[model samples]
Target: MENILEKLGIELNAETRLTGDSKFSFNCHSALSCFNTCCSNLDIVLTPYDILRMKNRLGLTSAEFISEYTEPVIQKESKLPFLKLRLGQEGKCRFVAAEGCTVYGDRPAACRYYPLGFGIYKNEEAGDDFYFLIKEEHCKGFGEQREWTVGEWRKNQGIDEYDDKNRVWMEVILNKKLYSPELEPDEKSLKMFFMASYDLDAFREFVFESRFLDVFDIEEERLEIIRSDDSELMLFAHQWLLFALFKKPTMNLKES
Candidate 1:
């Protein structure tokens, strides 16, 4: 989403386009002079899996986490719902402390991808995935001696897992962008999207407490996975969204 980058104050041009093998010098630690600066004044968008991980890490349900720590914002162009991490007083991240991030182990994907921005292009001819350096003027991490290929950075930051988990969600957003004006989702569809994307706890209730299984033919083993594993549930949610929004045959209906 080019608009997302612009909103975050990142300007990308031909010179900044990077492939997986492209090397960059950057390292962030408490020892760095500019450490924790990036955590403040950011419009951090939380993915579904990001919320899942963070909420579980904090022992909070998805609904509670959304209510206490996030603010919902609709993307201006895509008209899609995005849950942004709420900053505290002085415009600093609530999780940021004097030493470093308190929730460092379970930080959001955008925090994990610091100094490197990731995006996908929808062009049929050219390549789709690309990365670019954010090189903020005040970030001294770029001046460090440590160097890494984009792939290495992604691996070191555990970004691959986040990206993998978020792939289907990204596809949905991209599809919405591509079909904008032709496919305008109603208020109910938007609420469904938000629930499936951010409110995992509510989605769980919707799946189990409702007639969802009575209508859809989910296998016993898959149902168990969705019941116990948040990741699997997120995947199921994506499939459900595809079926609900685009009428894709991602799920089969039970026969009467």
Candidate 2:
């Protein structure tokens, strides 16, 4: 998916460009775009909130939604786990409505940003920066009626809060090589990353129906925290990634 985006020239300047001092305006009504034409032809990644909200909107259980709607696939070369939202017959987003987005309030961060998108990159020295830009080919909202600066758009879209929540996962994702460049990941690692990062249904099953709780010790309080905060999950996931890649066993649950 990332490769496709790159091949299509959809660069990931996630933070800097979108959040910077540029100005733009967008409004669906005035823009003469009543429906989602821009949602086609790309693999949109779904966050955990995206899965939950979309499932509830579609009136399906987490398990039911995943099995019926999604497929688990790794991004090429990097072998990173991410969920691709299944598209319709015409390559339209499944949740797109004739009226607008069916799940507007809880739409993914990527969707909320519209024509402007964000990306983050890590330098060899561990420094990270953000970039923003207009998307390719099909986006018509760039010349819409409303107007806003990059900062205004970020504030309006609540991207700062979203970034704050997703930072831990972002850190782990960007720093994969730092933990172990030569780690030969097995099927278990793939499944683990997929469940934890992408598929909410499988993740829920692993947390509730499986012995993940029994084998890896998470305290009641921390478990409660993870239930509420994705940052907490990312922190826990980072620990799991460390164990998975470097083989450093963290057996002392009390230590956390």
Q: Which candidate is the best by TM-score?
A: 1
What C-alpha lDDT do the candidate models reach, one value each?
0.87, 0.63
For model 1 the TM-score comes to 0.93
Off by over 4 Å in 2: 1-19, 30-34, 124-127, 135-138, 178-181, 199-217, 224-239, 246-256
For 1-256, candidate 1 gives per-residue lDDT tens digits of 6776786576777767788899988888888888889888888889998999999999999889999999989876567888999999989999999999899999999998988888776554656678888877889988889999999999999999998999888877777443567766789989999989988878999999999989999899998888889999998999898889878899999996
Q: Which regions of candidate 1 deviate over 4 angstroms?
A: 1-14, 123-127, 176-178
Question: Per-residue lDDT tens digits of candidate 2, residues 1-256?
Answer: 3554577576544343444777666655423543477767666777655665667777786667777766666655457767767778888877777777767776777787666666555555543354456555555665667888877888888777666666655655666563355664577777776666645545645666776776777778987876655445545665665566546563334332
Residue pairs with colliding backbones in model 1 are: none
